[model samples]
Target chain A: MPQITYIEASGQSTTVNVPEGWSLMQGATANGVEGILGECGGSCACATCHCYVDEPWLAKLSAPTEGELEMLENTASERKANSRLACQIKATAALDGMVVHLPESQE
Target chain B: MPMFRFDPYSPLVDADPFPAYKTLRDEHPCFWSEEAGMWILSRYHDIVAAGNDWQTYSSARGNLMTELPGRAGATLGTTDPPRHDRLRGLIQQAFMKRNIESMGDNIRDIARQAAAELKGRKQIEFISDFSSKFTVRVLFAVLGLPMGDEQTVRDKAVLMVQSDPKTRAKGPEHIAAYNWMQDYAAKVIAERRANPTGDMISQFSLAEIDGDKLDEREVLLTTTTLIMAGIESLGGFMSMFALNMVDFTDARRQCVANPALLADAMEESLRYNTSAQRFRRSLQRDVELHGQTMKAGDFVCLAYGAGNRDERQFADPDKYDITRKPRGHLGFGGGVHACLGMAIARLAVRVAFDEFHQVMPEYLRVQEKLDWMPSSTFRSPLKLELSIK
Candidate 1:
């Protein structure tokens, strides 16, 4: 089991055993994390599963494709260096101590 | 409210049946559907009560006809209270009033373009040519999606609301669509990352709740929700609007004569002929609504469309008077989970009515009967052919 830590907007911490092979979006969704709406499901089209990855864990992940780079421009939250779609990021052993912040709104 | 056998799929799909609605509104406050097998609240007050009362009618059971795509346990729609609050808060911050308003000019521009595409055609398949295409374009533009693969996306969305059991059983398409959209959105997000633009995606990428950063899933899901919500809702509104306007030439001309009253027309059209039918809620415990004792976890439906026609709520409720004040119509939904994209929906319709009437005045309706979207969740024309003679 891969240990995944979720930090809420209010600074509360929840560590869950996220199974490998599933995307981070699936992990959060399976655990009933409220912040992720995933309205379009795991499809990167919705961007409801947006997350700001911990800078340290960025290198191990797959670089975003051209299509994804364009969709991120539509999110309500501000664009930043570490911004990544959670659905695109598969939960892997390489990223065990990763932390994510919540956005203000997605509706 | 009752098991009214109205095949919205066949011909006469555009006919206005206010009398039928009034009867249901007066008599059946709450009735059990034998076919749908769910408790439906049709009266206007009852519909409002269900929507307003979150504890009694919960969204945690999910909103889509079946399990939401890629959703395993409880997603945003199926949860209540703190859980819903957390998700709603994030979404609200991104879809603020000012942000949606700022996009009004853009939405109008899209509506004009949609109408433009239908120029000179004698007959047009309203759903495929106009409503689906136009709404898809506008929504993806809002999401900053490239215009390359829009038709495919629209097709996928249409597939979602279909009822035919075999088609409904095909889950792979939806799952495939989810993955494709996630990929598309991710790529779009990356562009803003490299060279940050003024789009919402750029803003979300940089947003911070409490000094921490949003992970990948949050961004993707938010984008997905916006795209899906924007897609169905806009298309649904447009189809219903066209169905009403074409059928009632007088009401159409009234709006054309007074463009400023486009909003009034939209409000009336929605109240009189709402597309979203059941605001489905799952029961939390043993609760008695009207008379029936609803079992815990049973699906309790709030029939907004029926509610709008309820005679108890409005005098002459069966009449489609554009000028009448449609107070408390449950069209855009209610409470915390109320349609947050209403700002955009209103703007879209207001602009659509303004432009539609300007270009295609007195367009003739095609004889082909319209097909209603099959899913129990929503009630919009799947296809409506219109002839501009």
Candidate 2:
């Protein structure tokens, strides 16, 4: 299990152990993290699970696919250089100490 | 010992299928339905697994058990991925939550107008007078279609999904409605292509990706699919929710008192009695479940209504609880081929109820014997006469 920290827009932070092969969005939503809605149930169809990756861990994760990039354009929150859909980022041993910032609203 | 019977098309199952679903889930999770000539997956986990594995259970063949002629592989619901992904990507932009939320005021206005019409009525036919009218108007507004022809379009859309129980196939009227909608959609696509107005149809007509765009046939099929789903499926859901409210007075009272709970109530209604009862997927490979082997090329029906009420998934699956927060329920189906207009449907229903409850806070079913729509795929009260004072 890889532990990931989810920091909400209001500065409240919660850490949960995400099982291998589970997406960060799944971990946050399954563990009752308030920030990520995961409305599309981990499908890249809806960009409700928007998040800002911590700067250092950005490069370590896999790059967003074309489908995810297209969906990102529709995110309700502002897109930044490190912005990503948590559903696209699967949990792994490499991302054990990763931190992701939640957007103000997922809509 | 006699084998348990489960026929989706049977009037008995149509009236109340939950008990039969319970039997299927408990005794035969992957039972074969002899009447429909298809495999039925009734358990929650099994349906979800099958939906998620599109490669094993493909939609390219057809999504509907009684699929319309010339429908498979043409529209979003019928197509499998890569192509499905491409079509969805191009079409979903218009249905994004942010985009749909922007139409909130317009939706609310339509709802208000519809609710206002029943101000002095002692009794009202909910499906015809309110739910159908409201959904059709909202869908027309979204598509930028002219309003006067709603009655005609709504009738055709309703008939399009229906099948003849005796024949166990689509009736002539169904095919006629399908053809009419095809011609109607083609006209709309051409008109939108010639004069783009930035509406959903226009967006579909002009949406491009990497120098590729939807062709005329694709645009026509997509438009027709939306119109049919927008009117029949979405309107059916609204009627189902209304029926739930009427049946569950306590839950309804809670929703009325705290308007904020309306969204959750709507979701619970979706889980409790989803209008989308069943959808079919063709098997790409042989699969064994519960000692039954479903061979490749066999069609399997994913009973979403049954899956939502599975005790293994939700506690007290039969009870309608607004506070349950039944997330991940197959109310909107699941996997890559989930309902595309879900956000729109949610916003429309929430706003409609908010406006409706404001006008008629209390109502009851006037008819003791209710008639349900005769369709295997969709379920709703065909006519609901409600007494409103």
What digit string (tens of lDDT, one per residue) describes model 1 on residues B70-144? 542234455576555554444455454446787888878988988888778788888787778778878777767
User: By DockQ, who's the top model here?
Assistant: 2
Pick the lDDT winner: 2
Cα lDDT for residue A73, model 1?
81
Candidate 2: the clashing residue pairs are: none
Estimated TM-score for each candidate: 0.69, 0.90
Candidate 1 per-residue lDDT over residues A1-107, each given as its tens digit: 67777666667666667666556665665465666655433434456677787878888889985435755787778778888877667677877777877666655
Candidate 2, residue B148: CA error in Å? 2.3
Off by over 4 Å in 2: A1-35, A41-43, A51-62, A70-83, A89-107
Q: After superposition, how far is residue B240 of candidate 2 from its true place, in Å?
A: 0.4
Question: lDDT of model 1 at residue B376?
Answer: 56
Worst 10 residues of 1 chain B by lDDT: B6-15
List the DockQ of the predictions in order. 0.02, 0.30
